[model samples]
Target: MKIKLLRAATAGLFGIVLATAAHAQKSGGVLRVYHNDNPPSASLHEEVTIATLMPFMALFNNLVIYDQTAKQNTDSTIVPDLAESWSWSPDNTVVTFKLRDGVKWHDGKPFTSADVKCTWDTVTGKRDSGWRKNPRKEWYSNLKDVTVQGDRQVSFHLGRPQPSFLGFLAAGFSAVYPCHVPGRDMRTKPIGTGPFKLASFKSNQSISLVRNPDYWKKGRPYLDAIEWRMVPNRATRVLAFSVGEFDLTFSQDISSRLAADIKAKAPQAICELAQFNIQTQLLVNPIAPFDDPRIKKAMMLAIDRKAFVDILSEGQFRIGGVMEAPPEGVWGIGPEQLADVPGFTGDVSKNREEARTILTELGYGPDKPLKIKVLTRNLPIYREPAVLLIDQLKQINIEGELEAVESSVWYNRLLRKDYNVATNSGGSALDDPDVMFYEAYACGSERNYTNYCDKDMQARFDEQSSTIDPVKRKALVNKIDHDLQAAGVRPSIMHQRGNTCWYPYVHGVSPPQNSHYNNWRFEDVWLDK
Candidate 1:
């Protein structure tokens, strides 16, 4: 059922009157969560869905990690889960980490620095593939070398200093893995140091995880187990949640009204909606017609961002510039700068004329149309935006066609940098500026699919990554953002906000500042009895 404000009130009122069902929440119970997507490929190689794999970090550990509660403050001085403590060199190029003693993988193997070196080497393509897939091939191409100082400690020496490396280490994408296990077959017979071990996974159905008897954290992960079900149908998932068949489910399609109703009716459950760390934007290739700065500007001016935000994002999304949303208020560069760009105007005809003038100046006519394919996906939000862009482009006489491809095919095409124009999103949970800069802007960085090579920007990005001072670093980031926006390779329409709902009993669910809303550490969470 769709959520409405009125319905939410009624739900809340009714919930106050009768909710013996709420009592079911208690310690030592299995938390049934409905994941809206199918089980990812057997390999955990996809950066988007590595959390479900055996133990990237839950059982194993990382040198550093983002805190569960607070979004900022990546603690590197001490090993929160696996390592005990670490030290960095004066240049910040070399990092030495001391591992915790007596930790055992689910398979009963001792954890050591060798595993750390192997994990980094595997993901960075320095070694052969392992049981778990390597998702950070694009992000971790900078490691010069790694050393095992001893059984308990390891050190990573970078070819160049990377200030953001420590923060990247905290994220799940850069999670630590088991080196001894092979990646090819690890998906089925996975093992990790996490509180829960993968028990069984039924393709297209559900995956079950059981608590590890020898969990490192004493008497933790109070729940006996967790079952993650693949249920993409929004209405069905909500029905399951309402009926208590599923303890948690979050969907973008669910209305805010229905969320309020659930809050009113079942106070035991809370509806939370927040901005996601993502930018759904149109990326233009640098090929011929689009290569002209004037054409890009005209195209930018053609569409009304406010309308797209209203129709596609339900007015919940924020019109954005180079920087992404969940703005990371402190670290983010304000959006005010975009207002001054030549085509940043909201006027439609002005933009069209501008585009026409530019195209004509560059030698183009009705006979020689700037015909190109604007690829999109089946996502509901993408449909309206695609239509809006196509309609807007026609005004400027740019004949753009929309091609909707399967997400799998689309992503593959993106990685190959095959499309002329496309719309997509990238997420980072740490909310650090480096997540945006390094992943999206840095030259030769895997995420830079547009082949947008700018020597000046690359030089600045390199300089910025090595700077330890915050003020100087932000200034450098400002330059990078400005240059990227001016290049117009990827222009953002909006930064998406996460729309989700969950039971109140599902406490300690730490939403990522930049990734999926459902990303949470299940360790300290306990159902109220």
Candidate 2:
């Protein structure tokens, strides 16, 4: 099986599918899913928020996509989708893709190389008026140019060789669209060559999608249709799920406490646990006292990460910082190495004592405490953690005030550096170090909410990016990780493990190992009932 998807047309592809379908596979059921938030735009590229990606992932196809079939903690394996196959030039700076022929957009436009070029150009900030914001443009920071080779072929000229370039394209945000479709128009109606086509989308109501009969891959989209509704209240959503109104809880969005309750209510439902890269961190803002390295050290030492795991997840998750920190994570510093990093050790009492000393050195203790407002999302998951953070800060004589903001405004406030201290949750679809470092920690990164801009770390990022050898790159990444912990731009709280529940009747879903809820493989899903 030489990964023959590109040439599957001539290579007995139908035979394989038919053989697989023989295993009690009967299609035609509408999957009723739920997402909590109604998105401002239907396009995945426009906003990489989980609220949007949760529903629209099934409605679009990327150039290359993760092999959802891969059974691993992190499935970095890439497989062809919109692009039939691809090859790289000798220098590794130029990569070319062969588009899948006969694929048509929902609007009946032929899927071609132009679509690939246009999508990349827009994401890389080549277009101005149409794009809402290119938050993840750093994903293509090395991309020099995109050229259409022919009707079905395209080439990407890179300024430098990107080891994980294909992985970037495989991300859910990189889905392809008709080149002629304006960004605003695509977000309005939402059109793609995916298995399902958007039939209707209403703000804060419902999103209806019907199976695309013209899908290039035959016999796919087993579901006749998909109905996505917004249920703002998690309690109501879980109630509906227990009574069999919705098929599954939106992947990884439900809290562990709620998951236990859901399991008690619907014991018949299957609960799948996935450990993603999502981590809650107290972002040490770059404003004033936080800009002082000593204050950052004090804050980092004061918080107890294990308590967060013990309380929130019932000790079911790992505690880590920056890149993931060991056996549970990938390419990160192992425990022995991690012990050297600040705030990673398990001696909580000792760390807190040191934190008190540092706070006292800054000329304040319990008598004259340092009072600050801590901003958090107005959601149960975030608010609970923020409360814990306040308690932890109180131990160090830091009088903390909690302010909960709506989810919509929470991120914008962080992006604008509006808050002095905020507890935020963030995750990457890929566990790749390059993706984490550049987007969240690099200099001038819009996504760097803490406003951390270390030129030394930035230079190291470039070195690791250009380094061809994995061993050398790993060394650079470790050094960078150590520096990040020292800086305490964001103090790691705990990595979250999400338990997504689905009815036994809903079959063929492989839970995503990565943090992305969009990685749910709906194309292979079919209802047993």
Candidate 3:
């Protein structure tokens, strides 16, 4: 999973044909896109799903961003966006950035180092006013403070040396917010120094973004405007796309099956399939019955992970522990290593037999089945796997009724810990351990929807985060991955392999390979039509 290896792997996996400048890069067309659901809000800091990132990411600019031209994104590909340049202290505990001059927010407020300090202060809970839900607060847990030296100089002091700190800032979710704008106002009306500005947002209907004429980057954001229409039904959305209603599909929203159908219906479209590194997982609430360790173990043992892969992806997906597996994943363990983890072995019959025995010993059987509702988002990606999970649970006398809710409602339920069992997916913005472990699995993390916590595991998380040596840190990550699955801490079913397709006219775009969160600021996207 070295940088070179990851680049080579992703280059082949992405299968993208970069739009060349052979033809004059014509501008001024509205890039119409199909959104899967109505996003809860436009605030990236408060929401955790791609529902918010897809349409709203263009409205803001990160301090640093992954190279837009690269097919694969790694630490090496990180490039400055708002910041002109940056330097790290000799001890590596403090990093400073020289901000770009002449940058102005859409509201015409001058962008400065104070804005950077205000942004991190809001993110890390230093400011008096805070976001209602800072889902990624843990990403900055190592930061000691943010200080401003002058209008164009900002520094971030860390509690310890974190190698992946810059990569976190490069994430689409890591866009810098303005000092004058509060989090409440940002949820609906946001102002940023990006290539696009929000023109209109109609609840549950559509969002429109117009080009920023005075953007810092000159003559960029080739499209005059971007439009997203909310289409909750997958079949209806695909049908609309095939008939030339939408020019592009939402990032990582199309499945392989849907991609094939689109090609058949609209042969002129371009499609690319790759591992999104987002894992579909099962989360058990810390309520009664599930509070018992035996029940958790039995539930994990009963799950047939391969069945999920075979049925869901037509056997195109890969199975792994908490981290994404092998070549495509930098910190992920190999298949050989994953085989040693519990509930991951090939002997499905033996695993299910043990699961049945455990349930019987706990005084539950087919005659008196244990009934529970399986909660999931009302999207096909989540609903389909949830149905499969329920069928698998029947082997252990666990009767699960699937309860799929809207995207926003489902997330609210997860935050409130209001469900007994749920099937959900966790996507990492970066492939680094610090971003994944801290945000998703660390004790008391806002994104830890399962409410699973272990003091020892948290200590391991810290150890790996601070360790600068790649060799040593990877060993620690591997151990943590194994322990998570062995302890049934939100058992991961499979890593998804999804597709992104667009009409050939939609140019200068390549969906990120390792994550679905980055490379979305469509500054270079121009329609040939």
Candidate 4:
């Protein structure tokens, strides 16, 4: 039902609220959290999943950061991190940031504008030696060059004006890397100027981050350390949290049903439910039978999207297009408009009938069913929806076998186009069109796992990105979303509404309303107990 934010009403049981400015912050306690899976790597730039961001985001600082104190992150709430101040040139094509002096990397290396240049240069492919994979390189396609004025000043020259450029810098993945650290080393041993330092990252065991004592920000990172125990199973993670084994649950890791179970068991636990703006989508690879446009169209027509929301999320999730649906989302199409988009009509029976008819026309029916393996990540969130997708495909004579893989192997298989059909989740760091379209939909985008590239749609993406007027830009964005659905480009099932619970003793932690990525820097988080 489009839940923006729902908190447990029994406040007296906990007797404590999230730490406000007036509250006295307590420090010197380890915030033990349950991590869902082992991340592919520690490098934020190279990875797409929240597995990496949930643990490692605190280990680095961006040029700008979303105000951690804000309940919702907006353009106005973007505050400085490493950059003391920023300004734009006359035409808005060039933006510059004045560095924060006395800031040092976790390893005690002085932070400078050159490090900023090196970071973006590595992202934009100016330097070849650093990055193993530039997944979000398309996020900086408009960037002409990064020029350093001095040790403290840096300017980014954009080929065209982008209104959301500042927001991009504030994302967790946009953390500025140290110039001296090689990209390969970043995957395991990384260095940054954030409030926390990675003490150790034992794969499949735990990730430990200690407070950066030499952190530039004064009297910050109140917690002594943050420890994330990698527990692959969701039920086990939730069970442990209910019994006070963990101070906090992973970001958006708890389902609606699981939240209820936690409340029943641990009555004092604070549960915050909201739409994380992450969508579960079906990625259809261009293989022999699936390569045909008619086959793709039939595939899109077959499933029931509403069943996913009802069964998996207990009617808490919302059916949406590529962009997150409105209210929480800034640029998404409304329900009326989204219904008109192909496969989103909410008429599952009618849609499936059309799909079956198409299958029959293609000489496939109950006698000759299309057998395929539906690949999904070996996690509850991914696997559950995938199983539902297989059930729905059966209506149209598609015999689907579920193949769940590890997070690392799953991402690699998608990168190599190693699956015929897969169900996965796509998350955007920012709600802006530039970030969403370029990273996931654009031609040659590293994260474009489906390899569905339309030249016309790419041109339209640029048009909306360059359009300065909000109304005009939104119209263009809606058109792109419509076209994307019509073409069946990684057809989105539904935007997820997940729950995250934490004990009252954990203070100053703000769960992001729009994204699962940002607001994770636990610099201000403290332990009241």
RMSD of every prediction: 9.0, 3.1, 4.2, 5.9
lDDT to native, each model: 0.62, 0.77, 0.84, 0.85
lDDT of 1: 0.62
Clash pairs, candidate 4, are none
Residue 172 of candidate 4: its Cα lDDT?
A: 82
Off by over 4 Å in 2: 1-23, 73-76, 255-257, 334-336
**Higher TM-score: candidate 1 or 2?**
2
> Candidate 4 — which residues are off by over 4 angstroms?
1-23
**lDDT (10s digit) by residue, model 2, range 327-422:** 556666543555765567768889989998998999879999989999988766678899999999898889999999876677778778899888
Clashing residue pairs in candidate 2 are none
Estimate candidate 3's alpha-carbon lDDT, on a 0 to 1 scale.
Answer: 0.84
Local accuracy of candidate 3 as per-residue lDDT tens digits, 1-529: 2122111122212223223332468789999999989999999888888899878999899887887777777877777778767787778788888778899999999999999999899888888444789888999999989999989889999998887888889888999899998788888998888899999988899999999999887667799999999998889999999999999998877888898999999999988887777889989997898888888888888888878888999987888878876677778875577676657876888888998898899999999998999999898888999999999999889999999998878878988899999999767877888888888888888888888788888999999888877889899999998888888888888888788889999888788677888888998899888
Question: How far off is model 4, as Cα RMSD?
Answer: 5.9
User: Distance from true position, residue 413, model 1, in Å?
Assistant: 1.7
**Cα deviation in Å at residue 446, candidate 3?**
0.8
Name the regions of candidate 1 deviating beyond 4 angstroms.
1-26, 42-46, 49-60, 71-79, 130-135, 187-189, 251-268, 288-294, 326-329, 342-349, 359-371, 381-384, 399-401, 512-519
